[model samples]
Target: MANASNLVIFDIAANNITGPVPNNFGSLRNLKWLNLGFNPLGVNQQPNDLGFINSLVNCTSLCYLNINGNGLTGDLPSSIVNLSITMTELHMYGNHIYGKIPSEIVKLVNMTVLELAYNFLTGSIPDSIGELPNLGKLDLGSNNISGAIPTSISNITQLVALNLESNMLQGSIPTGLLNISTLEVLSLGDNNLGGVITEEIVGNSSQCVFLYLNQNFFSGPLPSNIGRLKHLVQLNVSNNKLTGDIPATLGDCVMLEELYMQGNLFEGEIPLSLKSLKSLALLDLSNNNVSGSIPGFIKGFHLIKFLNLSHNTLEGEVPKDGLFSNMSAFSVLGNSLLCGGIQALDLPRCQVKISRNKRKTFSLRIILLLVLLPLGSLFVCLAFIFYQYRKSKKMNGSVAVLHDQQFPRLSYQDLLLATNEFSPGNLIGEGKYGSVYKGLLESPTRTVAVKVLNVEVRGASKSFLAECETLRNIRHRNLIKIMTACSSTDFKGNDFKALVFEFLINGSLDNWLHPGPYQENERNLTLLQRLDISIDIAMGVDYLHHHSHTSIIHCVIKPSNILLDEEFVARVSDIGLARFSFFNTSNINQAQSSSTGVRGTVGYVPPGNF
Candidate 1:
């Protein structure tokens, strides 16, 4: 082996070599590179087996060292501080190595790339790390590193990337980091860091392209000068304590493609200037206090694909053109005040005015009035006779038609007992027509949701009848199953009308898309999960529209109307507005046209003159 003392490079990587490494490698005095990475020997070595690293320190010309993905155990050898002065790169990630980094690492003055991520390393990052004048990238992410980042890191003027994400680091970011104009990526997500992000923190850094500060405790508004980062492509500051209005200057980031600011305290209307972000593809502003109408100009976005505005105070009409046309790609639930969009949104319709020619309107009215006077008198006389006949028939009484339907004979007492006497604590959700309570039935040994109607409202009884009529005739795996309907009197002798359904423990899609404070913070649907849910919803709607015994139009089809069972399978529910129609094209159009006012919730009426 002494004959190889003049060797300048050794490249044995990704081979299945095993057994302890040789310790006489120092004989290769002129060795400049050693790449013994991705080998079983490196991955499964004893604590005293890495003595080769000590031997390599005598190789004055060694400049590069890579032993990553080796699953090696034991502390980083302290002799690393005695590496060659020309050493510039070191990669030792994806291992079981523990213990604090030796502060003497500062001796590697020429180091440029140092990656120690995905390991068991603990303790605070040593402050001397900044003494490496030419270091360009420093990654310590996904480790047990803790404590505040040393302020001296600002001294690394040549650094281009710094990642310390998924650590136990605490305290605010050092203000000096803003002065590093060469930094292109800085990730500090999933940490315990807290404190305000002042204006100066992001007022500089013109070259930054990606910034992630999510899952922290940072508060206050984003710096007004945030637009200064002309190269930024993605920015995420979600799950924080940030407050105040979003800076309109964000529009200045013309190159920005994604922005996540959900789960914050931001208020005020979405800045109109955001319309200038021509490159934006995803925008999440859910779980905030944003108000006002969704801007019509949003329809002009050239590339927006995903948007979430749920759990906010937004109101007025939802835009139907452009991205808003796809209900599966966006959400507007939890905004009870919103109205008027595509029919799929199931929102109430906005009133339209009749535009008439003022000059001929008066003459036209007079002409019609004179011609209809005699006909009106005869029509009224016949209507009075028909009313008297109907009154007499009603007084004679009739059989209970609602109870004769093919459903379980559930009485009011059964429901009351199942839902713990309809206690408020048993209530799970509330809607315009009624309150839904979670209940347990002993005979069936199953859980159920009991929707008890608020008959005191003007149209509550009609809604109950509509739901019963619709549920009894439809059957689909993706549609809510009706167990029974109760129409008996309550203890107070008031009219009691309720519907029992198969209980879905996971609640509605609305809650999952916009979780409140009490909901799981880390629960999120992946792309595959979302696609499956979308397919389920589409199949359910398809059956209602075409395969049912009678064609049915689901008047409202929002997230709140979609329930999820234990397996997360979607089910279309809330059929109070469903209307049966003929399968014939002409009859379908006639049915839609004759409907006077909106039948669905606000923000979801179909478009057209009707």
Candidate 2:
């Protein structure tokens, strides 16, 4: 073991070496380079021998020291100057070092590979870091280092890899550092740097491999010069505020592997130049306004594994290539005109068929030029026309019957005759959205119900068609059935309208739960009934949320929107202000599109409005 003194250095990094870093390492006298990084040594490569590592100072000749891979712990000695004056390759990565890195570290002038990354190092990185003239690879990533990246870091012209990612660093990205010609690996992602990503994000990208700027606050158009990084394997700039068209120059990155540009404000069509990326495996450009048909020629690319173009203004036939062959939830949503991908979405298709009679007549014209056949064909055509006309009239009658069907709906005169002309005795309830009146439908069939929206309001041209469309789409037992709408001109030739609805004997659950004395029977609701009502409401909300592919938030949730049926089933109603979380706001100007904004009744808006 005495021969260990002659051993100047020991290294076992980037290997499968295991167990504790031998405490006997302290005995090495002439040790100049002791490297054990990238190796699976010690407990999870952590070591108890770290406490004795300070004793290495006895080996005054030690210069190129590397105790990186094995688990070393505790604070760096505050007085490390005397032991590392000639140190050039000081690698202590994958360690448990804590407390602020002493400012005295700047004294190591000859340091080349100073790797203290993946440690418990905290506090601001010393500005003196830029003083190391020979620092080729300065890795302090996955730490709690805060403060601006010192501008002086640009002075290290020989630096090849400067990784300070996943730190607490803030402030605009230092433009000067990007000017360095030799830096090939620069990762500063997941920080508080907010601003436009300037052109000099990484100056010499000829050798750059991976550049991840995802989940940052960078705004403005994506740089057109991104093509300069010909060797960039993975470029993820997703979840930013970058606007405008994706630069065509990105096609210059022929060696690109995965391109993630989702969740940005990028507009315009998907660039055809993107097809030039031969090696790309994943391409995500969702949540944007890239309109136009998905390229049919995408089938040519067989290497694509994941392609997400959802929540965009894209329309027409979805591409049936690569990942599209299988029904994937990751593909296609928020596109209004997209159709014909799978049976999951019941898309309609038009069918055209040639009639046998027409075909036979055309054949007869070529073979037998007979007058009898021509006369018979004319009669048949006339008969077909009459039959079609009658069928159309019947369908129109059915629609009309459906239209005037709601309690056969009431006019100002019908309600006046039923209620003796708005007497206070006929009033049922009154609230914001209008008043309600209890009236009976007379004649062959008579039913009792409330009349709402007074004669003046009802006399206007009402959009009952749209209201009926929205109402019939929902099916809840608690909601009153919209029987039909009545539309006609009043005595002054002005439009007067009303919608007749089936009235529940017990009325709204709101009056029941709130207990008004005039209708005192509401307090009779049992605990079981209340529980059943709560369950029904929750189920309704759940259906609006998960059962459908997209989740919907019932923004105006309150007691008034809840109604009780004759069976005491709690029915949630009035989804007038429900908001979809993933809806795109920019498309609101488009006709018949979704709304994504501050919505809901006055009392229920969350902190972040839309």
Candidate 3:
């Protein structure tokens, strides 16, 4: 093979070939194209496995070389700078190549396409990378590259696609990078990039078709002139610190197929102007401050596939057409005010409004009698109830207790210290009843999730008592383990109550399923993993329903209540709404009656419960 000096093209891609690449490629002096892609050419992990590239320098006519997906390791050699000056394309992505990209690579002035993505290469990207005048496509994504993206990249006049996503790049996006007239694909997601995206950045990228800016620290409103990108297809700015209302002008991007703006501080109603996005397939605006009614126009989005608007303050009747009719394709959870969706959503029925003119008017004397009679009776009943409550309080004292004697007790001060005085930074989640914080205990030397009940909220105290009673005796591998309970008064003498549970390292299943900004890149669950989680959840629910000493019903079972350990094992949590059922026939009917009324989260309630 070393004597084949006249070989102009050598192609051996996707053959699953193994072993080290031959180092005699220099013998093909006239070689113009070389492809050994998708082959296990260097699986032996030998040192200097890429020394073969040095021999390719002798092939003066080499114009293209592809060695991608070869499992090749070792530092990318600096000798690559000596490659033929005529080289136009170099592909070495999907390998184990490490070390810095040589700054001398600028010497390959004729290079047009440089694909070195999906490698272990670290260090800052070379600024001189912009000097490749003919370079049209530059992909350096999914690496450990750090430092700011070079503004010099804006000098590539003919640049087409620039992907720097899933790296550690910091600093704001260079304005010039968005100004390129010929640039189409601009992806810089999952980085440490910050700063407000200015109008000039969005306005200048008229030719851009794909724009990914998710999972960053970028703040401020999306530029209103973003509509200038008429050709934009997919726009993702999710999981950033961006605020302000989503721009109505965004509707002008009629070609948009996917729009993801979840996990931001975006507010206001879904824009009516968005009716123009007839091409939209996936739309996620969950975990934002967006409010107002779920628009009926969304039902007109016939091409929509997935729609998520959970955890927002949205209200009113949820439309039940098109995407909404498909329970698996859309989610409207956490918006407690939403109602009247498909039966599977189990939302409250929309109330019928009656016109004022249709009602009969009551006489003034009857109105006063009706109001004053109730007021007099309420005052008398309250006085009698207050006397009895005071008598009962005097007899029992103010001390709260868990019926079980096995669990240890914690004080308000102990919990306050463990959670750093309930610092906002330690807060991990919030619910209608309370806020959950991650805390570290000193005596036991363990981490725990501290759920502090907000006594001010109606039913909060009841929920706390219910949780303590439910978790006291129930023991299952798939059930969250309770560490202790706090039923003491704060320094202010106000009643304070909290429950401490063993912390799960991986957080809740909700994050794994519909990940927020920080969890976006790291919380991908595989199909097999999902199946395992489903089984774990089923076993937990089965134990609660049939296997426990007294059959218990976990009235509220949702993703946020399901915790995951480091090994991805699922644990059912938040049993505050649980109900116990005794085996006796008489008690069984009583248990069924006690479970009536609004028992669980609106969206997660079983259809029969409605």
* Candidate closest to the true structure, highest TM-score: 3
Query: Ten-residue segment with the worst summed lDDT in candidate 2?
Result: 589-598
How does each model score on lDDT? 0.84, 0.67, 0.87
At residue 530, candidate 1 shows an lDDT of 83
What tens digits encode model 1's per-residue C-alpha lDDT throughout 296-377? 7777675888899999999988998888888877899999899898999899887655566854797898899999998999
Q: Return whichever of 2 and 3 wins on TM-score.
A: 3
Query: Candidate 1 — what's its lDDT?
Result: 0.84
Instruction: lDDT for model 2, please.
Output: 0.67
What is candidate 2's CA lDDT for residue 256?
A: 85
**Candidate 2 RMSD to the correct structure:** 23.7
Off by over 4 Å in 1: 1-3, 16-20, 40-45, 351-610
Ranking by TM-score: 3, 1, 2
Best candidate according to lDDT = 3
Error of 2 at 293 (Å): 2.8
lDDT of 2 at 131: 84
Cα-based RMSD of candidate 1: 22.7
